[model samples]
Structures are given as C-alpha cells and as structure tokens.
Target: MISAPHKSSGKTLVSLGVMYNLVQEGFSVNSFKKGPDYIDPMWHRLVTGSQCRNLDPFLMGAGNCLDSFISNSDEKSFSLIEGNHGLHDGMDVDGADSSAGLAELLETPVVLVVDSQKMNRGAAAIVKGMQSMPPKACIKGVILNRLQGARQEEKQRSAIERFCGVPVLGAIPKDDALAITERQLGLTTIDETADAETIIRNVGEKIASCCDLQAIRSLFSQAPPLKTSQVKAERKAIASVSIGVFMDPAFCFYYPENLEALAKNGAELVFINALEDASLPDVDGLYLGGGFPESFLRELSGNRSLLRDVREAARSGIPLYAECGGLIYLCSAAHYEGETYPLANVFPFEMGFQNKPVGHGYLDMKSVCDSPWFAKGERIRAHEFHYSKPFDSSEIDAYQFEVLRGFGVTGKRDGVLRGNLFASFAHLHAVANPGWARRFVALASDYKVKGRCAV
Candidate 1:
C-alpha cells in the first residue's frame, strides 16, 4: 500500500512511475486504488495494461475491499495499491477508518511518501509520527519528494534516514511537468489530454530513477496469492441489443468493466461522438457516461445534428442510461459560463449551476417504480458527485424517480428517471455492483429483440 502524509504529495505519480518501470522491466504487475476514484485508475490502466479496481471501505464493506482486490488479481508478480487522501484521513468522527486502516486491514506494507520541500530535519518528525501512529501499520520505507539539488537531496535523505530510522528509498526532484492537470470534475479525463501517454512515460522514468525499484518489488514477494470464485457463464444468452456509447472527450467517464460486462452479456457497444459527430449511431440503446460536458457545452450544442438524433432516438423509446454530466446534457438546456446551450431534450429539465446544493458521496437507492434499469422495490448502491441541479420543478416532474440516500433537490431521494431514461447524479463503479452491467445488457437485449420483432 502506497500512502502519503497529505493529498498531492506525489503518491499517484510515484505509483504510476514505479508501476511503469516495473512493467518495462518485464514484471507482471497488477494495480489497485484505495478509494472510488475513476480517473487515477485510468492512468494506472494505461501504464500497466491492467484494469485498476477500487477498494473503498466506506462505500463498500470491508468484505468488498478484500473481494475486489482478490477478484482482480491475476498470476502477476506483484500488486500495487495506490492509497487515497492522507494516510490517516477518512470519513469518521475519530478518523478510525482511513487509508492507513485499509493498509492494516489488507496487511499491506505502507511506503510513506514525504514531500520534503520546505523543511530539513523537520521531515523526520512527520515520518516518525506516521511510523509510530499505528504499530500494526507496517511502514516499509520512505520516499522524499520535491528535493532541490544533490546537496539538499543528500541532506534531506540523511536527515530522514538518521532521525526517522527508515531507509530513504527515493528522492524525486521538483518538476512542474510531473504534476497532472485538474478541472472542476477531477483530474482532466485521459481523453482530453493528447499527451497523456507521453506524460505518464516521462513521469515513470523520473520516478524509476529516484526510487529503489528492487526494494519495492521485494514487498510483493510474500504477498498472499489472490483468490476469487470463477465467474459462471449465464445459462441463457441475454438479449442482444445495440448501445450507442458517448466516446468524446467530454463524456468518457465509463468504467471499462461496465462496457465489458455489457458485451459479455450480449450487447453491441456502438461508439458515438457528442462533440463532433453529426448524427447518433443506429442502435437500440444509448449510454452517456459522466465527464465535464459543461466545459464543452458549446461544442456539444453546436453539434445540432447529434442533438436532433438523440432527441429522435429518445422519442422512439430507445433505452437511454445517462449519469451526472450526461444527465445534464439530456435536459432541455445547460447553463454554463454565463451561456445557455440547447441539449437533447430527453427530459424537460433545465440544469443550472449553483454554489449551494452540491450533491456528493455514497448513495443507497431503491426503485420506487418499475424501470428498465431496475425493478420496482429493487435496491441499488451507488455514489453521487455533482454541482448542477434542475432549475425548474415542472421539468423534474416530467421525469419520475426518487433518491434514497444523498442530496437530491426534492428530498433525500431526488433524481429524474422517466420512460426508458435513467438519469441521475450518481457515478457508479461496475465492479462494486456487477448487477449494473447485467441489468444494462438485459435492457439493451430486450429493446433489440422488441425492435427486431416489430421490424
């Protein structure tokens, strides 16, 4: 388990760098993230060529944490877990369940990353505290990040080694290019950055040079082999339906497992461009995953033909599944940066930006009415993180749905799902709830069979 004293302390960069270098050295490495982060894992996947699974104790139970880790592991040589937030920070009154807690639970050794820019010997105190905080939490070594020069690097390295009683595994020089970009959503989605691969590779080399790769690899030597139940094949083929997946830079927040599950269950995945594509791809279903659609609202709205195609598709009763940013695009209009742009009017709602009512966090939802995505009375667990809300109540009335847990406009349960449309502020990770993929494929297949029969 790789951790740091605080956020943006180069844990993610270091993780990627280490993983990349290891892979280049021809070692089979698997990657995992500590929390419900979709973007960071994307980078890890790009570098290691393996899907990075999320392990969040709060959203998922402790059992889920172990299950997800074991399920995704292969016959790889080692598994690297990139932690979230500060080592001892989590969502609890007494901070009982932080990333450090997760490391302890998994019995994974913690490689503490210390950002040693300002202080000299003071860095030792921080590392000493982290090492002593939980005796059970195994802190293997320390990596000094943002070291100035050879002289300063040596000084900081010696100070940490002498005072902290831990070997300084690495010392990374301060480089602005090493930092990843960020937007309102989170780190800029991989689709938006043209040089993402190059950036990741360069960052990897820097990390490889600074850090002790041999020592880090040894940590994984004795890790217990991962075990998981083999996925049983479905007795019957799920209906085969065509699903139009939004693939532009603005709408690329889908979990790979979600799409993979859909295809495995017999759904045809068709790629669509919301920014430049003229018309929607012919399909029985439409899926718009989350991203910063607001940033590209002008380009999206300017693609009038695509909007017209979606509006027509929805009118024809094509099953549509849109989340957060995608939901914003389905509304009558999106108000972003002091301009209102027309959108695919699948629902009558109009989304307006607001400082208040920022919906966020783990959500537990139960279907109040029967829908294609979920049956009536079905309970689903997901998460929500957004800042936009429906501007008009009348528009929300046009759609029918309720939120069970989280900040929805009307009450605790507020999301607009009407007809075959499933629009909500929640962002779901498919691995956490494999049923989401099954249900999505099932819905798409049903539509395909119905369409074929009608034709």
Candidate 2:
C-alpha cells in the first residue's frame, strides 16, 4: 500500500512513478485505488494498461472490500494499492475506515510517502504516532518527496530512519516541471496532458534510478496470497444491448469495475464525445458519468446541435442516466461566474454552484422511481462530491430517491425524473452494486426491443 502524510503530498506521483518503473522491469502489474476517485485510477491505467479496481471499505465493508481486491487481483502479476489522503485519516473521527485500517485488514505492508518541504524530525513523530497507535498501521518504508538539497536529504533521511526505525527508500528533489495541473475536481486526466507517454516514461526512469525497486516488490510479495475465488477468471458476455456513454475528458469519471459490470451483463458501450459530437449514436440507452463540466461550460453550451440531439433522445424515451456533471449537462442552463450557459435544456431547472462543496460524502438512498433499474424502495449506496446544484429546489419534488444519509440535490432527495431520464449527483460503484449494471442492461434490453421505454 502506498500512503501519504496527507492529501496532495505526492502519494499519487510516487505510486505512478513506482508502478511505471515496475512495468518497465517486465513485470505485469495490477493496480488498486483505495477511494472512489476516477482520475487517479485513470492515470494508473495509463501507466499499467490494466483496469485499476477500487477498494472502498466504507462503501463495500471491510470483508467485501478485501474480497473485491483479492477477487480482482492476479497472483502472478505485481499489485500496487494507492491509498487516499493520509494513511490514518478516514471519514469519521475514529478513523475506522482509513487506509491504515484497510492495510491491517489485508495485512499488507505500507510504504509512506512524505513531503519533506518544511519537514524534518517532525516527519518521524508523525509516522511514530501512526506506528504506535493501538492498532498499528504497519508502515514499513518511507519515500521522501520534494527534498531540496543533498544535506537536507541526508538529515531528513537519517532522522526518519533513526527515530522512526523505518528505512528511507527514496528522496525525490523538488522539480516544478513535474507538477500536474488541476481544475475544480483534481488532477487533469492523462488524456488531456500532452506527450503523456514520454512524461510517464520519464517518471519511471527517475524513480527506477532513485528508489529501490526490488524492496518495493518484496513488500507486496510478503502479503497473503490472493484466494482462489478472489482471482478473476475470463467470463463471456451474456447480455446483448448497446449503451451510449459520454466518455470524453468532460465526462470521464467512471469506475473500471462499473464498466466491467456492464460488459458482464452483455453491454456494448459506444463512447461519445460530448464536446465535439453532434448527435447521439444509435443505442438502446445513454450513460453520462461525472466530470468537470463547469470548466468547459463554453464548449458544452456552444454544442447546440448535440444538446438538441440529447434532448430529442430523452423525448424519444431513451433510457438516459446521468451523474453530477452529467446532470448539469442535461439541464436547461448552468450558472457560473455570473453567466448562464445553455446545455441540453431537457430539465426545467437551471444548475448553479456554491463557493464550496455543496454535497460530498457516501450517499445512502432508497429508490422511489418506478423505473426499470430499481424496484420501489430499493436501497443504494453511492459516492457524491459536487459544488453545483439546481437553482429551483421545488422542481425536484418528483425525484426518484429519498436521501437517507447525505446532502442530496435538495438536502432531502436526489435523482431527478423526466420521462425516461434520471439525473443526480450520486455516483454508484458497479462492483459494490452489481444490481445496478444488471438492471441497466435489462432496461437497455427493453428499450432495444421496443425502440422506446415502456411507460
């Protein structure tokens, strides 16, 4: 497990560099992300060319999360688990579901990534506290990031090793050129960055020179073997339906397992670029996942022809499902920076934003929509993080889910309903909720048979 002192401490950069280096050593690597983030896993996929599965204990429970990890893992290939935020930080005060807690559950050794910008012995104290906790966090090694000079690196490395009794595996110098850009959500996707292959190659080469590759590989080798059931096997697709997905950089927040679930349920996904595409493809249903639509408001609004096509698709009874940014894209207009940009204009409400996060957490809800995806009162668990909201609150009175454990679209409910369209801020994981993909495929099958949804 690759963990950090806190968020933005370059844990992801370390993981990326290390994984790329490992792959260059002729090792087939499988990657796992600790949280519900989409962008980081995308980078991991770009480096490894394999699906980076998500393992969220809070969402899937400790046992199930481990099972998912093992089930999705390969015993032959090297596995790297990239944790979120700090090693011991979690959703609640108790830190029950932290990355450290997850390491304990899996009995996996951890490699802590530290930013040594203004830190020295203080780093030892932090890792020592983490090591001395009642339930030890099994922090094995350290990777110092952003070290300035050779003198500073020697002192920082000596203090952390002598005081904390852990090895300092590597020290990366401060390089502004290595910095990745960010928007409202987080790092820009690998798809957006230029010369991505060369960038990843350089990262790998640097890490291979700085860090001890053999030691990192040895850490994962010591972990318990992946169970027979945990190892995935080839399965033939069983369902037959075409599903159109808004799959460009603007709508690129899908979990790898989610796509796997849809494929297992026999879905043939047609990826559509919302920014440049002028019309929806001939498909049974449409899926719009989450991304930074606000950043490209001008481009989205200018694509009037695509918007009209989407609006017509909904009217024609296409089974359309949308998440956070997708919800905003389907609305009449979005308000940002004192301007209104027209989108699909399918919904009556206008989307607006808050200066801060309007809703962010694990969402617990019960379905109230009489739709094909869920029976009335079906419970669902999903991840939610958004700053945008609907301007008209009462307009969502007929939404599909009653929010049981989150600040939904209106604090009490989410999942807007309009004929065959369902839009919301909650992002569901397909692995944790396979029923979601199954139901989606069933709906798509129905729509494919009739060329319209059955009201």
Candidate 3:
C-alpha cells in the first residue's frame, strides 16, 4: 500500500506513475483507493484501463473493507492500494479509520511517500514517528518526493533509511510542470484533463526510471490474504424493472456497490449521460448521482432537451433520487463564476457556488419530514462533499432531513422534496445502506405499477 506523511505528498501521482509503468511492461494491475474519493480512482482507471475500486475503512468496516478489496481485485493481477491523507489521520483522535488501521487490518506493508521539498533529515523523523505510532504502522519502505538534485536525493534517502530503518524505494525530483492541476477540490478528474494520457505516460516513465518495482512487489507480497465471504445473489420480485441512472463526465460519482445493490434487488441498470442524451429512456425511475456539475454548467445548460425532460419527469411525479451535484442539476439555476446557468429547474431553489466547501465529511441525519424514500424520524448515516449552497434559504425550509452530525444544505438540514423527487447533498453508499437499493427499486416498481402520485 502507498501512503504519505500528509496530503499532497505525491501519493496519487506516484501511484499512478508506477501503475502506468507496470502496465507498459504488460502487467495486469488492479488499483484501490483508501478513502471515499471518486476522482482519484478515475485517474487510476485511465492508467490501468480497468475499474479502480474504493476500499474505505470508515464507510465500510475493516472486515467488509477487506472483503471488498478481495472481491474487486483480480487474483492474478498486481494490486496497488493508495491511501488518502496521512497514514494516521482518521475521523477522530483514536485513528479508528486511519490508513494505518486499514493496512494493519490487511497486514499490508506501507510505503510512506515523504515530500522532501525544503527539508531532508526532518523527513526521516516523520517516517520514524509514523513507524512507532499507535495502531503500530508497518512502514516497510519510503519514497522521497520533490527532491532537488542527486546530492539532495542521496542526503534525504540516506537519512531516512539510516534513521527510520526503512529503505527509500524512489526519489521524484521537483518539477512543477509534472504536477497535476488542482482547485478547491483535488486534481481535476481524468476525463477533464485534456492531456491526461500524455501526463500519465511521462510520469510513468520517470517513476519507472527512479523506483525499484521489484522491491515494491516484494512488499505487496508480504500482505496477509483476506478471507472473503461467499454470499449468494438473491432474486427479487421486481425483475423486469429498469432503473435509469444519470452518468457522464458531469455526474458520475457512484459507488459500484450501489449499482450492484440495485441489480441484486432485480433492477436493470441503464446509464444516461445528461451532457449528451436529450431524454431519459422508458425506465421505471431515475437515479442521478453527485459529481462535478459546476465544472460543466455551460454544457449542461446548453442541453435544453434533457433539462426539459427531467423537469417533465418531476412534474409527472416520477420516482427520482439525486445527491449533491445531482441536487445542483435539479435546482432552478446554478450560480458559479459570477454567472447563472439554467439547469433542470425542477425545484424552486437556486444553488450558489462557494469558493470553499460548505460541507465535507461524514453525516448523521434524521428525516424531518416525509419524503419518497425515508420516513419521518428515520435515522441516516451518509457523507457530504459540496462547495455550493442553496441560494434561497427561506424556500429550503421545506426540505426533509435534519443533520444530526456534519453540515448539510442549510447547516443543519438537507434533502429537497418535490412530488416523488428526493434531492440531497448527503451521498449514501448502498453497501453501508443495503436498504437504500431495495427502497429505491421498490419506489421505481411502485411507480411502474401505481405511479408515484401518492408519494
């Protein structure tokens, strides 16, 4: 597993570089990300030409996390798990959801990527401290990043290996041109990057020339294998129901398990790209997930047919579900970059863009009003990541959920309801909420039979 002393320490870049380089050498690689990230995995997928799965220790417990890792990763392929943030940073001071905790759970050796910019011996102290930190991290190696020259690399590498007792597996020199662009969120998604392939190739060649892949492979081999449970697929009553999901470069933040859950509950999944398609198919209902709608507001606004279709669906009382960016799309307009862009306009609210995040963490919520999905007073555990706010606060008071923990649409509340529509900033992972899929499918089936007029 690849980890770092802190965020922006070239963990994703190094992992991508190594992955591309390995693929160049004809190795089938399966990559995994250690947190609730939808973007980084896209870059990994572009590099490896395969789906990159997320193995979040917090969203899924250690046992289920390990099982997920085993389930998604190919046994014959090389597995590369990348950790987000620092190895020890978690939800609380106890470090319960830390990368180190996940690594220890899988018995995976960690290769700490220490950023060597503007420091040398101090890097060793960070590694040494991490090695002895509680949860007892097994720091098997180190990768020195942002080195100046051969002399600096030798000094930093030697100091870390000498003091921390972990070998420096690689050294990436300081090159501003090599770094990926970043905004309030992390790096731009792979599809958004124009020269992503070229960038990955260049970085991969550089990492291949610098890093010892054989040693990295040895460290991967040291991880103890996780035992996965064999649960048979259950057939359901609504086998013919097809659930439409909005998926594209604009809105593609979906958990693989979420789609699988819908499938397991006997719903046929159909993906529609709002940026391209003009209308939803004759499916039972729609599922619009969270993603970077703000980045493609003009294109989304230009898609008038799709906008009209979604609005018509809302007016027809179709059972529809939306989260975060999906919620932004369903609003009257999205105000960003000093301009207003017309979207679905299904609800009576506008979303105002913020330069910084309004909500960014785990959410504990309770249904404050009756919605198509959740009942009143029903508790929910989900996550929120957004940089926009509901522009009309007075209008938003009619929404459903009250935040018990973590911020939401109006600091304490979220989930906008219009007819059978359910829109919220909090994203629910179906793996964590198995009933989410069942309930959503049931709504779609009910819509197909009796229509969602009652909802």
CA RMSD per model (angstroms):
3.4, 2.3, 2.1
Task: Give the distance in Å from residue 348's predicted Cα in candidate 1 to where it truly belongs.
Answer: 1.7
Candidate 3 structure, TM-score to reference: 0.94
> Cα miss at 277, model 3 (Å)?
1.9
Model 3 per-residue lDDT tens digits across residues 1-455: 89998999999988998888779889899999988888898899999988888887677767668777777766688899899999999886777689888888777789988889888677788888899887777889998888988988888888888998889898888888888898666888877889999999888888887889778778767877665566344555556688889989889898878888898888998989999997778888889998899889999999999899888877877888999988989989989999999888887788898877899888889898776688888887778888998877687546788898888888888887766788889887777777778888888887799754532
Tell me which residue pairs clash in candidate 3: none
Pairs that collide in candidate 1 are 239-445, 403-413, 403-414
For residues 88-205, could you state the per-residue lDDT of candidate 1 as single tens digits?
A: 8777654445788788777788899988888787888888888777524678889989877788778777878888777888889889888889865567767777899999999888
Which portions of model 1 show Cα errors greater than 4 Å?
Answer: 93-97, 132-135, 148-164, 225-239, 355-357, 364-370, 375-379, 398-405, 409-411, 452-455
Report, for every candidate in turn, its global Cα lDDT versus the true structure: 0.78, 0.84, 0.84
Q: Rank by lDDT, highest first.
A: 3, 2, 1
Write model 2 residue lDDT over 218-272, tens digit each, in one string.
8887886544343456485865998999988789898877777788889998999
Clashing pairs in 2: 71-230
The TM-scores of all predictions, comma-separated, are 0.87, 0.93, 0.94
